[model samples]
Target: MIRSFAVAAIMAAIMAAIAAPVAAGPIEDAIAGSWRKPADKARDQYRHPAQTLKFLGVKPGQTVVEVSPGGGWYTEILAPAMKGNGKYVAGLANPLASVNAAKSVENFKTKYADKAIYGDIGIGTFGKGVADIVEPGSADVVLTFRNVHNWHMSGWDQEAFNAFFKALKPGGTLGVVEHRLPEGRPDADMKKSGYMKVSYVKMLAEKAGFKLAGSSEVNANPKDTKDYADGVWTLPPTFAKGDVDRAKFAAIGESDRMTLKFVKPK
Candidate 1:
């Protein structure tokens, strides 16, 4: 009897071990879902969406707010991932305030009009105020990608961080993915260029009452030299030069990016 019990216990342990990865299937399936466009899929190599989301500890059933989900790039992935069990809030710039912002919001609405996939998705306006976009202490995870530089350029970086802090509950996570400048790059340069120094971003977040929880290099591209004619816009996806050495920029792939995670203290 004892021998049989030992064998059964070991078998159960092995099965549980195997089930661990299987249990993570929902997130992986959502990423690979048919709803994604071919172009979006092609960028996965540089974006590292799966690994980045995993690193951010994003899971189903959690309320997630994506700040400035411009063009709904991440929205396409996040909405499906949170489809049945979780909630996704796309906090956009107030469309009423800017023509460009209006276009972005309209595009997002058109993209996710399908109730079967994105009916539960919420819309909020940010960039002007905290409560205007997301409710205070309501989000489990707040994410922003490649947007801090714009905020800094507009002299709203501190306010943006403070808004993020207010939106997240105590112990909530903030995930940031931004084009990275070399360590010694000046703050003034970041205002004009899209790339930002990781240290500066961290300092701003700290000032907004967030603790630097961790950072990941999953999106880093070492080949990028950070001296492009148009800064980060010189890289692929933007190629602001308009076919000027397009192949050269393509070969370099995307800009080196810093993936940072910050947490509001309980």
Candidate 2:
């Protein structure tokens, strides 16, 4: 009996020690805590915050920016998450993205009041079609989720990628999550299917003077078939098919996504 009791005590001590080293700090707490009961239902369709932020390497006392914070999905979590020491900025696309920016700002303020910080999410048109908002080298990390395909469709992939690279401080991290296509797919496939070629994304980042840090399967969907007929939009989160074949898609869940972390050169 005594030996069993001692073993249990030792196990408890080891667990606590492991947890202590990686305990979520103020920023992480604020970010994760924002998803309370009411919001939990919707979060299932959103990117998993724990996995996404972990891959982004979000830490307390750092400055982070979320690009095109559509519908304030991530903004709702990032504001209070960085309250005590870190700062959270929502960098929306310029005049084109004003409607999105205003909506995000209002939602964030209602959720966090002034505890969360914000910057000029509105920037006028720049060379060609680039946004001239966020300042250069102003952030520690910039994250964009599931928005790259839209940019590619609009022919602003390189422009947006370069903007992210220029806006971060030397050695700042850029985290990208996009619907992914299988290797060797045609460029035409990207347009039909939401999945982008991983090589294309890497080359774009490298050309922007950023280094590939790492990648994760946190959001990968194995069932994705990478076909032209019904690309990523065929999946649940998008469900472009809408009751056409609900059961088949319900089994597939979300689109297969690539989660990559890149860093701007120092």
Candidate 3:
């Protein structure tokens, strides 16, 4: 009995020792400082800047890729955050909406003007008909925000997920943020409303051979009805229908979104 207890104690001590330092890395500090400037206006509807990235487990020196980086909101932050010791790549869709795509590239370029610090990071475009843009097992992290639902609507969700999985190195991370619908909801409702069921996200990740790491509520918005007359976009963020009723839209704010973290198993 004494020998058995001693063996177990030593194993526990080793495990704790191994995990202690990684828990205190500079990644947390970088994430904490992601958005230190103006906090309102166009940036208000975004997911909690620092907290969301931290939950996604972004490290300073890792190769990270953001897909369909529209307008470069997150791209502006990501490039600087991964500067010096890391690589940042934005994989955009080929032939993006003319105005939006051009603006995205321009904004990203302007954000990382100091090449010495940010390294050689540029926007990579993949054609629309192709499924994945990333090289198999090349990146340490693959991220996307509000892009999966559109993939689902376009019947390319499976291909997209597969590409994401292939792009990550073994044990790499995939961070996702999407408008959320409640779990177990019927497909009909999901089809009409842009919000997606969490179960579907989990299932897709699993199908792509990823293990669900965890999830977060950093982006949750309680006022979301998830049943807007014009769908999720009817809420504050997009408010597609302008001049309809500003106050009602203002009250709803942004749609509740599921923030997920998945790991490509080694």
Task: State each model's CA lDDT, in order.
Answer: 0.89, 0.73, 0.78
lDDT of 1 by residue, 120-180 (tens): 8899889755454677899999999889988888878899898888899999999999999
Best by lDDT: 1
Ranking by TM-score: 1, 2, 3
C-alpha root-mean-square deviation, candidate 2: 4.9
Better candidate number, 1 or 2, judged by lDDT = 1
Best by TM-score: 1
Q: Could you give candidate 3's per-residue lDDT for residues 1-266 as a string of tens digits?
A: 99999999999999999888765444434334434345432554556767788899887889899988776667656776677778788887664657766776676677666665445775665434655566667899999998878878877787788888888999999999999987766876666678888899888899999999999999998887786678888876678788788788877777788999999999
Stretches of candidate 2 exceeding 4 Å from the true structure: 1-24, 31-46, 96-128
| 1-266: candidate 2 lDDT, tens digit per residue | 99999999999999989878677665456454534445544544546777788778987577888876666766656666666667777765443447764565555445545443432222222222554436778789988888888888878789888888888899999999998988877788887678898898999899989999999988887787767367778777567888988888877777788999999988
Instruction: Tell me how far the alpha carbon of residue 178 in candidate 2 is from the true structure, in angstroms, after superposition.
Output: 0.7
| Per-structure clash totals for the candidates | 0, 2, 0
Ranking by lDDT: 1, 3, 2
TM-score of 1: 0.90
Which scores greater on lDDT, model 2 or model 3? 3
| Residue 21 in model 2: lDDT | 66
